[model samples]
Target: MEFLWTSFEIVGTIAFAISGALVGVSRRMDIFGMLVLALATAIGGGIVRDILVGHFPPNSLQTGFYVLLTLAVTIAVFMVYRSKQDHHMSTRWVRRIYLTADTIGLASFTVTGTSVGVYAYPQYPIFCMILGILTAVGGGMIRDVLAQRVPSVLREEVYALPAIIGSAVYYVFGYDGAWLYASYGSFITVFLIRTAAIRYEWSLPRVY
Candidate 1:
């Protein structure tokens, strides 16, 4: 279980970095701006969760691995994006790639955070689920805010909802000991829903 959690953490970090960098590249941000967005999207949620749980300084800040990883990804994206623009690379392909990668990050981070929250607050299942949802979408919210855009969670119908549902699933399975790989199950649920939202253009009913 520990190994699985660690694996997701790294994968989530990389996926989030790539997704954020993709957004920056599309926005025509400079190298520094892109790096900043990538770093925030990669680890902002984890930092927020750590602080909320009273973990001082946050474990993410204590390590250079995530920072280095984000930096590398941002630079790589910058290089590739800039080089390919001359060939008229379509933003459609970029959007498709970002959606796929971001969905993975959302699900992975949510499950990992829920697992950590369960261990931290065994008696408070609700708190665990909340932390899980926050861990999943908080970074994206921050990213959008920094970019002067409305956060997707506020407008996208099924965006944060998937994470919320995933966290709930995580809580139930973990509480009942239904499976050894509950986290993975929750991840799959979130990923599938997000994919559906993108494919079907699912949206909440608009208020008049």
Candidate 2:
């Protein structure tokens, strides 16, 4: 269980860092700004989750591992995007990269966050679900706000729905000794749903 949990956190951190770095590049931010954005998107949700679980100071703040990892990812993204920035980047390719990274982060965090909730408060399923959803979207919300854009969850796209469903799936199957299975199931479900939503351009009804 610890291994699986740590693995998901690392994966989610890397993915979110990539997405955040890309956002910084899009905003034409400097390297320091890019690093800031990357770190925020990578660990913002986890910090929030820790607070909710009463884990004081937050794990990310306590340990420098996640911050270091995010810094490495941000630097790599900066180098690559900087190289590509000189040349005209294809909008479609950029969008694809951002979507892929963001979707992966969303899925990975959903599993990790949901698992934390289940382990922390097994008796309260709804609380678990809410934590899962918040943990999945909170970082992206922070990233978007920093970029001066509307958050994706508030957009018409089917963003939070996948997290919601994934959390529900984990809550239902995460009991007993099925935690590993539940984690993988939840991650895969969230990934596939978000990927499909992007491919199909799925969106909720707009009020115009």
Candidate 3:
């Protein structure tokens, strides 16, 4: 179970890093900026989670492998996109990648965050749920801040809501059940909601 959780975290980190690096590229950011975005988007949530759980130095900082992985993934994504000059990177392509990355990362982080909470605290389901949402969205929040854009989770479109729902589901089912079922179901729910919202251009009403 621990190994499976770590695997999901690594996968989510790589996917989110790729998405963040792509954003940096699209925004014409320099190499350093791109790397910064990649690192933040890859490890920010784990950093927050560690801090909240009182894990000094954080697991992300303790393990150099996570940093290397994010860097390698970012570079690989950039190379792949750069090499494909003939492939037009339309808004649709960018949107598709972003949505896919966001969905997968969200689901993976939700599970990881909830698992950590359950393992460490075990008594606070609300805290576990909140941590799950934070883990799922913290990196993206940091990425958006660095990019000078509103965080997607803050917008109305059932973004963070999905994390909340998924966390609750995990709490109810516990970790003993089928891993793929919970993870895939949560991801599909989030993806469908987000895709529908985008298709309809839905937005929360502005409050004065």
lDDT of 3 by residue, 1-208 (tens): 6677888788889878887887888788876788899899889988988889998898888979889998898888777777776656566787688778877787778878877887777678899888888998998899999899889887646678778887877666655566556555655555566666667877665676
Q: Summing lDDT over every window of 10 consecutive residues in candidate 3, give the lowest-scoring window.
A: 182-191
Per-candidate TM vs. native? 0.94, 0.96, 0.87
lDDT of 3: 0.79
Candidate 2 C-alpha lDDT tens digits along 77-166: 877776774346477788798899999999999998988899989999999999999999999999889889899898848999999999
lDDT of 1 by residue, 1-208 (tens): 7788888888888899998888787778899888888888989988888888998877667878888988898888888887774535486788888999899999988987888888889799889998999899988888889988788788677898899899999988887664355788899999999999989998887877
Which stretches of candidate 2 lie above 4 Å from their native place? none
Clashes of 2: 0
**Model 3 segments beyond 4 Å from truth?**
87-89, 175-208
RMSD to the hidden true structure, all candidates: 1.5, 1.3, 2.5
Alpha carbon lDDT of each predicted model: 0.86, 0.90, 0.79
Sort order, TM-score high to low:
2, 1, 3
